[model samples]
Target: MLKPTIISLLMASQLVFSQKKPATTYKYGYNGMELIVKNNKETIIVSTFNSKKAIKDEIALKIYDMYTKKLFVNGDLLTISGNEAKVIGKVSIRKKGNLVLLDFYYDEIQWKTGLVEAYED
Candidate 1:
């Protein structure tokens, strides 16, 4: 009985700590332009390739939400095609008054090909 009770408690805690499911999703031709909806009330989209019309935009997207009382983790999204092998660091994408600033880190890297276009789905 005690073992089952402990298992149930662990499962409940796991659910409480899991990341919230995305309320809505964005399908875009860019790898890092996923529409970020916060509080289910605000939708934020960073311009791809410094332009909202930039299709086939290649980018590097960092995801993290670690935070403390004073320190907030930064999840920066950047487009790689802007430099096309010229810029080895994070690049800025500004368009339609939207800006996605980035900082490059070489400590750890992972490449994915989930490029998409900006649109609600």
Candidate 2:
């Protein structure tokens, strides 16, 4: 009888805790994300005007490391460890006729992907 009550109480506690745990999320758009993740005892922001964009006529990739406070480019599936967090991802750009495609994949925390159908604007 006591064992059964203890088991039920433990299961209830587990359910309550699991239901109350907060979820991490990101605001995805052309303007980029302000705070991609703010959990796991660390914070990671975009820290840039634009993480993915097209300049002139070519696709330019710029990844900002909040930990190092440095900018990287043309990093295909690159990985880096920041002062606060670690980043591993890539942004691929392809041109199909008059339309351009941009695939953005950031990290395990969140992804900032975009599909733009613009030439060079």
Candidate 3:
């Protein structure tokens, strides 16, 4: 009986250690552009880049489409500026007017995605 209990405890410990922790950042590469999202204080910070330059319209649209197909329910992409747009969903993605910030809103505890990048945030 003691041996069985010891085995069960070891197995339980292994399972606990094997589970992945929640991520606070994600990076995605699309058509040569890199999109990054990080949790900052209480807000999510998003940015995009192509080589060394910032990515605009087309790339941002593509990212929105990709995320929509993968994670969100049906939603509309609303243009906010020449460089950005927002996808309305359970978790909304909105572009900041300055062209450098993308605001993401969702309950982190309830949101999960496979696109989370493995790099440090």
Candidate 4:
């Protein structure tokens, strides 16, 4: 009886430890040039890299601009040419006159391609 109870307790403890915590959720900013979202105690690039066209159309675009080193909100749909990438979240960009930003993601293949292309001729 005692052995069985001990084993059950051990199993329950393991179960609790093995369960992963849920990813954290973040709210979109209304009208801002940059925003940051955090998950699991880490800062992942949730959105960045908006183009100029998005601003003209007033459509919400999430982008991470490598040149600016900051996130921006634009007005365009995030597009990935290949099947490896998908939108991780629904991003919103607040409209305020002529300024705009677009949201984008670096999918697994897109990310890998960048690495490979950087070293290629």
Model 3: how far residue 45 lies from native, Å: 23
User: 1 or 3, which is superior by lDDT?
Assistant: 3
lDDT measured at residue 105 in model 1 versus the true structure, 0 to 100: 26
- Please, what is the whole-model Cα lDDT of each candidate in the order they appear? 0.33, 0.39, 0.38, 0.35
| TM-score of candidate 3 against the unseen true structure | 0.23
Clashing pairs for predicted structure model 1, backbone only: 27-117, 28-116, 28-117, 28-118, 29-116, 29-117, 30-116
Q: Model 1, 1: alpha-carbon shift in Å?
A: 1.9
Each candidate's TM vs. the true structure?
0.23, 0.28, 0.23, 0.27
lDDT of 4 at 106: 21
Considering lDDT, which of the candidate structures 1 and 4 is the better prediction for this target? 4
Per-candidate RMSD vs. true structure? 15.5, 14.2, 13.0, 15.9
What is the Cα-based TM-score of model 1?
A: 0.23
lDDT of 4 by residue, 5-117 (tens): 99999999999999855432323322333445444544433333221222312222224332134442343334333232222222344433443333442211122223211
Q: How well is each residue in 1-121 modelled by candidate 2, as lDDT tens digits?
A: 9999999999999998787334343344144433343455544344322233322111212343322333433335655343333334564444455433334454322123322221121
Give the Å error, residue 107, model 1: 24
lDDT of 4: 0.35
Q: Each model's number of backbone clashes?
A: 7, 0, 0, 18
Model 4, 63: alpha-carbon shift in Å? 13
